[model samples]
Target: MDLFSGTTFKRAVAAAVALPLAGGATLVAAGPAAADEEDYKILVVGKTLGFRHSHIDDTTRALIDLGEDNGFTVDVWDPPNDSAGWWGSGSPGQPDLTMDSTPFTSAEDLSQYATLVFVSPVDNTNSLNPATPRLLDDTELAALQGYVHGGGGFVGLHAATDTMHTVPWYGELTGGGARFASHPQQQTATMRVESPAHPSTAHLPAVWERFDEWYNYTTNPRADVHVLLTLDESTYSPGNNAMGEDHPISWCQNFEGGRSWYEGAGHTDASWTDPLFLEHVLKGVEWTAGVVEGGGNCVTFPEVDAVVAGLNTSAVGDGVIAGAIASLLGSARTAAEAGDPATAVQVLGGARSLVDHLSAAAGDRDLLASKIDDLVDWQTGLVDDGPALDLAAEAELRTMGGKQYLAVRVLNEDDAAVDITVTTPYGSKEFAAVAPTKNAYQAFATRLVEVPAGEVTVTATAVLDGETVTEEVAVAYAGTA
Candidate 1:
């Protein structure tokens, strides 16, 4: 069951009890029991030892606003903006959010956040203040590394790649095996949407022309990261450091044990107010921080899709890593179709190294293969953990055109397909031969248009494991889109 048993992959472990959370506003989060445990609070580290961006305050304000609307709170840790890190005077207080001026002390401080944001942090070696020791000292850098290696979330904006560039691993981790080299003048350039399905790039156009500072990296990141957006060198002058045909602008990756998302834009102060850019930044935070409500996983497991698309039978070797990934993908899909999300998710972790590995062969552990196992887990989790259904059966109340309607969504989350029947005080709906990893849905009109938000009960019946099973629970009817 050890995925990294050798240079090559082996079989996978099975899953035990599972209770995956649903999608949308109904998505359930393992919340903090006390104020000391803040899972939804994000720490934005804007400490700069070099040139400080003028938009740092604007970015923080925008992030706070976004967090208020979304489900998270924004905490700033920028000594440059405000040693205390809170915008006490200029910004309006958000009552529903937790706005704190916590300092980034150590690795322990990093644990308090769902994700850590590096907003235009300058390189530690570039000290502007002779008295200041600068950012990410040896202790701080080690802390950041350990935090990321232990399943933490990291988001880098604009100059984040420029920060911590003295360390090779830090540079690669921040920019996906590439370092920020240089940039040209600020101008309008075209951006190409490489993966429109990604939450950050979903709202973008196929060919987007925007005015901002464009960055060029020393090496291409496509080999290490799942690129979401690419830049067209033809649209603008990339200076002498042009990356030519395949320049990556924005990307996401599964690091050693966590998730990292980076973007090469967000330089101008105007970008903070831009609707497209805000949505991109908001979703990036949501995705890296364990997929909050209404958000989606960032990485696209190419390995899984290859199997689904049916790779040539002659192309796989029984002992190769790619072949093992193929086997694992099949097992996971079978588990999902059999309504065993646990087994499916467990199996998917074995194929993380195989993602984007177009050249991996048998018995060879191409170092690249072991980098994205958590990403594989994420993709597998979405097989049935997608936005629609998070569990077996649930009821929701949706509103459209000033009328209320009851929505019932059902998923096969057991080990076998069955006949599912969902009932409520309003009516009942039946699903015939519902298979595993599949979904069924029905809606009934309701007269609760003027009613306040409340919970309603639903009865779900299904024959699971050769036994007649029935479950009744009160479903929340409020906050449906």
Candidate 2:
């Protein structure tokens, strides 16, 4: 039985409206009379063997409408299944694709389409489900890979990351540098356009706020791909805060032999109707189809260097500690300039440790701390090193002697003897010798202190390698128990 022999194949090749090009011009596909007809065809696959979104059908219709407006032909394909039922089951305009066989049974069938748009093609979590049919068998997966590597285009929608978790090749092909870890409650948050020059984000504002499920990736993709949009974590309650302040929501990259684009937005049905969002999708489609040219490659070390230099000028302060930080920064820049981003990142990591110690010692919290954080973020995004020191302070509420106290945790990543001195508003304490361990350099030091109800500045000093470095941090005290 031929899978696409019925209405499925017929509808897939159904004629679409002429595609409109730039300057109000339209590219008409040659009619049946022509021996070789050239058509701009798009395939939208919304097959999900796992958790499905209610907006899948709506998204498909929206793309079809876009095709009509832009002069291209779109074919929407949803897997022939009703095991879990549709989003709005039994409702009018709901997609009902029925087929006796699979459409993507061979490479020849899949190669007919030029651009492939995956709208949440999720797989089941149970890898051992023998009864359930695999979305793309080994052959089909290879065919799709060959197609994309042969210059075909791919655009992955919202839950694309949630799909194909078992297939490692699919991850690389879709620019799944990071898997979807989790998402917070659907809320409105500001999205900063990272690559305004790219076609996908060129129409977007510098900072645009929209409501959707903001996702946190298991790994940050900024280092491996060109990020188009980043969710401003400060603008919303980032549920887990896993990706830190610089969270990327959308990115694009030229992967393998084809163009790959993925955006973390589009979880809601309303998003399909949004003009700006639709335009963004259209631009990505056009870019993948070779209609527009930009978003060339992933970010390089030089770009990271430029950002680091700017941050150093604006954020770094003055002191003996500051001088040491400046020297480390210089060395990192030199390493990067010499085409050693890994070494640069390692040196930057050491600088971050020094900054963390300084921030704890001097009791200067906001400005210098923020600057160091920015530098560390940039450094982390440039390379992948295992088990490196992430210098930062953590605060926790504690009770000491039947009184409320703020416990501050200052961490050090290196394995060296560090001399620590802490000065609080109440009194000063010094630890002559702090031993190093894998967990922390100063494990025995008491970061907990008692102060009046309000904000109080505390200074810490660390003497290491015969150099004295100091930092200050402001601690807020609620009240005594």
Candidate 3:
């Protein structure tokens, strides 16, 4: 029987090729080699136009080892030599190190490799010398866009999120929207595996404790991509705590027509040598290389534009209600324009609630409410937010005597004393008299609550005079009681 139409004749001939040996023994033949036997080609691009990592060489070695151990070929691309005078150091006694000076100038040049891995590519960080060359030019950026949209694969590590800021297309290719804002000091923190079934995280524990620079992204990409790992803010001290509770440390997405995976875990040199971390990276590479089957696609660009238009349209009209809606809409628009879509989404949620309250105030409640709903729905779809709350609070996970507890620190910017209520999945507790410090706009209040061992969502509510503000944060607990 013929398995395939085009290969029937070839199969028939091969089947009839059996012959007797010189010793009068019949020879048995084996089938064709499997597809896995073929070697996969990978391109490791570690070209930093800004702050370079000391572990770049180690990362390259780890990737080379991963390729050798697996059935793949690794080609490391360093930036300085590829662009020549476009990138170089002014210091003396510098070896002027370069790895494979071949430039990726076009889509054709990029097509030869199955996937591209970026290791801490930074640009324009050195203010002393403003003439630092960028890693990707206009044409090359266009090529990368075309490549990813044409079903290429991309894996970004550490400062890959920090690179190619000037090029919007590059950002979109490497899951751009949410850029690196800041990172706390290198400390040990627990990471919750959002997608344990994912090949990149299947071997990881439910809660992974690792030491590295935990990045606090400017905005949460959870609304845009499939988050694979999230840093438990309560597990470690977050310097800025800008992202609040839901902080995504690593995520993957099937962007456009290509596969994209990014992990913010490789800031230190030891990360490249860790078996678990290396395995995680190797699995990401394999997935991008089409060796594995998983990842998420993003919302279409046209859909996002349509939502933005709706937001603009809903902000129009004439009335006191309209003026209030317009004011809130203006705030949302400013946040989005300032490259903080997360805040914009949160503000829009407040705007939606204000519109809801205007049902009795609006002259045409039905018509105006419908328009407002459409706008809120469209805008909210592009970004994710928790409950709308004015005050910000920090929740820290703690354990003592085998009992898991949450040490929540509340910050109130309001002048009046606010009554705070902290609720855990296990139970709820209230803290009274959270007052601002003397002559300071910030106030601090601390609360400790016992929680069951597992992942739990903690909600903090603050009542000022009469108005109530609520915010919820999730924390992972790995304790006995």
- TM-score, one value per model: 0.55, 0.53, 0.52
Error of 2 at 19 (Å): 26
Best by lDDT: 1
lDDT of 3 by residue, 34-152 (tens): 23446767888776655567777788888988888987787777744233233455211112334445446776777767788987867653232435555676677777777777677
Q: Tens-digit lDDT track for model 1 on 395-480? A: 55666677877766665665555565666656777777777777667877766655455444434455544556555444555443
Query: How many angstroms is residue 162 displaced in model 3 relative to the true structure, after the best TM-score fit?
Result: 0.8
**Model 3's lDDT to the true fold?**
0.60
Best by TM-score: 1
Where does the lowest 10-residue lDDT sum fall in candidate 2?
Answer: 5-14
Q: What is the per-residue lDDT of model 2 for residues 98-182, given as tens digits with 9 covering 90 to 100?
A: 2334556655666566678888776663354545555587777877877777667788888887766667777766664577778
Name every residue pair that clashes in candidate 3: 50-122, 254-296
Structure candidate 1, residue pairs in collision: 320-362, 339-414, 353-369
lDDT per model vs. reference: 0.63, 0.60, 0.60
Residue 298 of candidate 3: its Cα lDDT?
23
